[model samples]
Target: MEFGVSTFITDEGIGAADLGRALEERDFDALFIAEHTHIPASRETPYPGGGELPRIYYRTLDPFVALTAVAAVTERLVVATGIALVIERDPITTAKEVASLDLISGGRMVFGVGAGWNREEMRNHGTDPATRGALMDERIRAMREIWTAETAEFHGEYVDFDPIYAWPKPVQQPHPPIYVGGESERAIARVAEYGGGWLPRGNVENLGDLVAKVRDRAGWRVPVTVYAARRDPAVIESYAAAGVDRTLFFLPTQPRDETLRTLDEFTELAKRHT
Candidate 1:
């Protein structure tokens, strides 16, 4: 299985382009960056990781824009949104951004997405917290039309648009791979339906069973990619043996030298896996 780094690239860390080049240089297969438009100062949503929200969450660069830089500088690395908050953005505009990034990167974009956990943040974007799952589903469905059709339109409970022309359809036919990121059964079903792949976090329980279930439903059409996978070789090996297509280990947010030092360690882990 291929191995890579998944990170939150921020204003204070090693720049995205530099980090991307470093990953490619070390033979890492992909670079998956995280996203957060803005964190609400008054947010009551507990951090999913279960503690005070990390400073990185507030300092992240826009995933799409940072990835554009990453793509411009690296030739072979796959540039992706580790999990873009589709529930917090307009589908039409976001579609163009994804397609544009795909074109710019010569078809090497993976659209990893989720309905995020921050209720205040979602509200700030004019999205209702209660119905975000449906909103995310429809937005993704709508984006598919934008990427594929010359004149596309979609009418759904959450997304409604008339036929419109959007330039620069993605270089990858039908668009870049959409790796739905979550651990729920609904997420697994979504993969069977329209997802190009799956991006469940590596800590998920009963991962082997989930992998088997997804494969049974969609055959090889939906490959499983485990993100933020443990750095341990044994852990990564377990994922590979369970039929994971790729494992992206977490990279700590740090400046150039510190980041590179940690990357060297992860690179060694990748060497064993790759």
Candidate 2:
């Protein structure tokens, strides 16, 4: 199985280019960055991890911009968005950014996306929290159209556009692989319907069963990538046995020395499994 690392790229963390080079040097498969345009100040939305929100959430660099810097420095490392908040983005512009990054990176972009969880955050983007799922679906479909077609157009309840030409088509044949993120049934269904793979959050109890469900729904082999997987050799082996295609461990956004040390530890874990 491929091994990767995901982290919240913040201003105080290791620089993107530096981190990318480091990961590649360590022989890691990918570097996935988390994205949040801006965090709402209100504390209405509880943190997913069930604690005070981490400081990195508010200080994250734009994933596309950060990943571009990563791609510039790395030759083989897959640069990805661990979970880009598509609900807050313009599909047309996001499509171009994905394509441009893919082209410039020699087709090494993985477009991992989600509907997002923060209600007030979605509101800031003029998106209704209740309908964000449907909106995300339409936006993804619309972006796929923009990526593949010479003259693309899409009309839906949430996304409507006329045929227009966008250049710098992705180097990957159709487009970069879209990995739908989340662990819910709806998220799995979305993966079956439109995504190239599934990006499930880590520490699932019955991961093999989940992988089977996704494959059954998709009627094909759907790649399953476990995000935030624990950096344990046995855990990695368990995931591999459960048919995981990749396992991305979480890297704390910290100082360069500390971050590299964590990577070194994870690299040792990877060696034991590989």
Candidate 3:
């Protein structure tokens, strides 16, 4: 039961370099940053949390650049995108970024990706909101091809490319773990089909039910990571009993002191469970 923390990497938050050092000092398992390439002005997609989006979404730093800064400062603290918006990014370039970050971090990169829920945001990237699931699927498949093949090619509805060589293959064999994020049935299937794990959003009821359904339906023992707003011990125990491999706590802000305290608390939680 490894513990991780996710926060917005904004201009005003703790710098990624400092955050990395802090996590390493506290011996936390990983540091994940959430992503939103560029939120559109149109308010077509309601906030998943049922409130106005945070200003941090617009002020956030690029995830790869921020994680790279983190890698430069830490030795063992894993870095990741809590939910990288692959729908808005190019899969080929994204694969190289993941590989480069993994190499720089000594293979401690977890790629958590999702087909985001913002309709206007996807439209801004020229992606159809209705078909994002299919698009994301092809992107994941294409990325795997790029990561594992000496000369790779993929032909799908959303992604099609001729043979091309990709350099600096990921240090981790067969590439770093791709954790599919979201709770829909299609999302679980996507994880089983291409990802190394499933990253279910927080606020899930019946953790055991969902974990069992995913395992029974997908026929994969992929890890299920819960991203939660609260880290109550009882809740953690319930999730652990349900076979969740890791539970990442969502931090409200990235202040160094507050984050340090949470890391210590969560580390204690991890010690008890793991």
Give per-residue lDDT, candidate 1, residue 83: 95
How do these models rank on lDDT, best leading?
A: 2, 1, 3
In candidate 2, the residue pairs with backbone N, CA or C atoms under 3 Å apart (3 or more residues apart, or in different chains) clash, namely none
lDDT of 2 by residue, 37-147 (tens): 898888798888899988999999999999999999999999999999999999999999999999889999999999988888999999999999999999999999998
* lDDT per model vs. reference: 0.90, 0.92, 0.84
Give the range where candidate 1 is weakest over 10 consecutive residues by summed lDDT. 215-224
| Backbone clashes in model 3, listed as residue pairs | none
Per-model TM-score versus the true fold: 0.98, 0.98, 0.94
Model 2: worst 10 consecutive residues (lDDT sum): 229-238
Q: Model 2 off-target regions past 4 Å?
A: none
Clashes of 1: 0
Scored against the true structure, residue 100 in model 1 reaches a CA lDDT of 96
* Model 3 lDDT, full chain set: 0.84
Per-residue alpha-carbon lDDT of candidate 1 for residues 29-122, written as tens digits (9 for 90 to 100): 8999999999998969989899899999999999999999999998999999989999988999999999999999999999999888999999
lDDT, candidate 2, at 164: 94
